[model samples]
Every structure is written in C-alpha cells, then in structure tokens.
Target: MKLTETTFQDGTPVDGYGPGFFRIGGQRYEGAVLVLPGQVAAWGGYEDTAPLIAAAGDVDVILVGTGAMMTHLPPAFRSALEQAGIGVEQMASEQACRTYNVLLGEGRRVALALLPA
Candidate 1:
C-alpha cells in the first residue's frame, strides 16, 4: 500500500490538541478557539455567538467541540445559528478536530468552534 499526504487546500488543518490548548497550522492557541477557512481566532465558548454568526456567509456547517465529552448545545445558541442558516454539529473536542481536518481537506466549507480536550 502507498501512503499519501493529506493536504488542506482551502484552510488550515488541526495539527494537535491537548489538555488546555490546540495546535493549529503550527500555531498554539489556549482556551476555546474558532477556526474558519483560512483563519483562526480565540473563541469565547458557547455564549460567543457573534463570531460564529458573522461566519455564516463563509461556512456551510460548524463542528462544535464540547471539551472532552460530547454534550448538547444550549437551546438559545443552537437556535441563533439555525436562525442564521448555519448548520451546527456538536461532538467531543477530539472528534471535532479530526472531523474538521477531514472535511477541510476535501475543500468543503466548514468551521470549528472547539473547547479544550
């Protein structure tokens, strides 16, 4: 079998993640983070909807990382994004990171709102 490198043509892929931080595109970011195509920013968790909302036009879906365990998003928060026509998927941080990288490598319009794992 031959091995091939995965290349993300549209955005930065998640490189690694740990207890309180994530290494994205070779950059370290602590706390929650929001990663959109070609950009990454410090996120303020679920309550911080402005940045996600602002990205509605740039993304088709957002994968939300709920720390180490999977959890449901707040009703209001989910509602707000849905109202903005943004699709939201909630999963554990580790999974979110992996999924985000896969979708990004496909050149899909996707984003990540991740909590530390």
Candidate 2:
C-alpha cells in the first residue's frame, strides 16, 4: 500500500478540531459548524435545516458529525434532506472531518455539519 498527500483542489479542508472548535483554512470556528465547498458557517444543529436545504443543490452528500460519538441523526432531519435530494451520513465528529477532507480532495460535491467534540 502507498500513501499520498491529501489536497483540496477547490474546496476548504478541515485542518484540525478540538473540544468546541474546528480549524479550517487557518481559521478556527467555535460551536457547531457547517462546511461547504469554500464556506464555513455556524450550524444550529437539527433545529436549523434551512442552511442544508438551501445547499441541497450544491452538495450531493452531507457528513454529519455527531460530537464525540457516533449516533443516529434525527429521522426528520434525514427525511428532510433526503426529500431535498441530499444524502446524509452520520459519524463521530473526528471521523466526519477526515471523511469530508477525503471527499473534498476528490472534488466530490460534499459538505460537513459538525458538532464540536
């Protein structure tokens, strides 16, 4: 097996994340955050679905980081996004970050909604 340097062609990659914050493109964001191709914004958890809804056309998948543990996303949230035609995958926050970066590096249309660990 061989390893290759990870790179984001046209998307922002998550550089690091901690208890309540995430670093991206040399900037750190606190609280739950939403990451798009080149944009990072605060996320309001399950209550705020508008951002994801609006992003449906731009992203094919959404990586949901459920804090420090892997848990199921609310059915309503999943339904809402599925209804809008966006695929949702839930995992631990840290795992989500790594997956998001890998997909982004491949130039796939993906986004991340992370709850800080």
Candidate 3:
C-alpha cells in the first residue's frame, strides 16, 4: 500500500494506504493498515482495542502501543492473544510511534494508541 498523503490522523485529508512511512501528529508510523485509538491507553485499552480491529477485518497480528515510554505486556494476556492465532507486539510508545507507519507500509495489521502528545 502506498500512502499518498504525507501526514495521517492530523485531520488533514486522509489518503489511501501506500508505500513509505508517515508521521502522525509528530509521531512516526509505517504505512501499514493500523488501527488508531481515539485516545490514549489504559489497562482496558489493550483488550478493548484489539477486538475492535479484529472485528474490522482479518488480521494476523495486532501491535499494541501501550503509551509513551511503556513496554511491558501482561504474560497471560499476551499468551491468550497468541493462542488465538493473533500475535501481539508491544513497543514503547515512541517505538510504537515510529513503527506503526512502517509496519503499515509493510501491509501489517496494527493497532495504535491515540495518546496525547
């Protein structure tokens, strides 16, 4: 997918998914099919957000962006996700920030936290 627009999720015109990465409101992301949270994350966000994406379409994995500077995944929850055949990847908010766009570019299905900057 080639995301024609330079900036996504900033209220500017949203372009279809395409190649290259993107910066979402100053946070970098890949050009993958990412699920953006309307707001930041909390304990329930992970469970809440994942199913939303799953409902949207078929996905092999869901990248969970916890929040700024956080990178820990509850073991049981992680295992459950795995058992369901959906791999879960948790990155520091910053890494999530950067990788979201890149993974999108790679055509990966990702879910992002809409944390405030």
Ranking by TM-score: 1, 2, 3
Question: What lDDT score goes with residue 112 in model 3?
Answer: 56
Candidate 3 weakest ten by summed lDDT = 10-19
8-90: candidate 1 lDDT, tens digit per residue: 88898999999999999999999999998768999888889998999899999999999999998999999999999999999
In candidate 2, stretches whose alpha carbon ends up further than 4 angstroms from where it belongs are 1-4
Model 2: per-residue lDDT, tens digit, 15-45? 9999999998789999999998668899999
Estimate the overall C-alpha local distance difference test score of candidate 1.
Answer: 0.93
Clashes of each: 0, 0, 16
TM-score of 1: 0.97
Window of ten residues with lowest summed lDDT in model 1: 37-46
- List model 3 lDDT by residue over 1-117, tens digit each: 876744343222112222344344445445332444342223244454455344334456556655544668777767766766776777655566556666655555555542322
TM-scores for all predictions: 0.97, 0.93, 0.51
State the lDDT at 82 in candidate 1. 94
Span of ten consecutive residues with least summed lDDT in model 2: 4-13
* Candidate 1 total steric clashes: 0
> By the lDDT metric, which is better: model 1 or model 2?
1
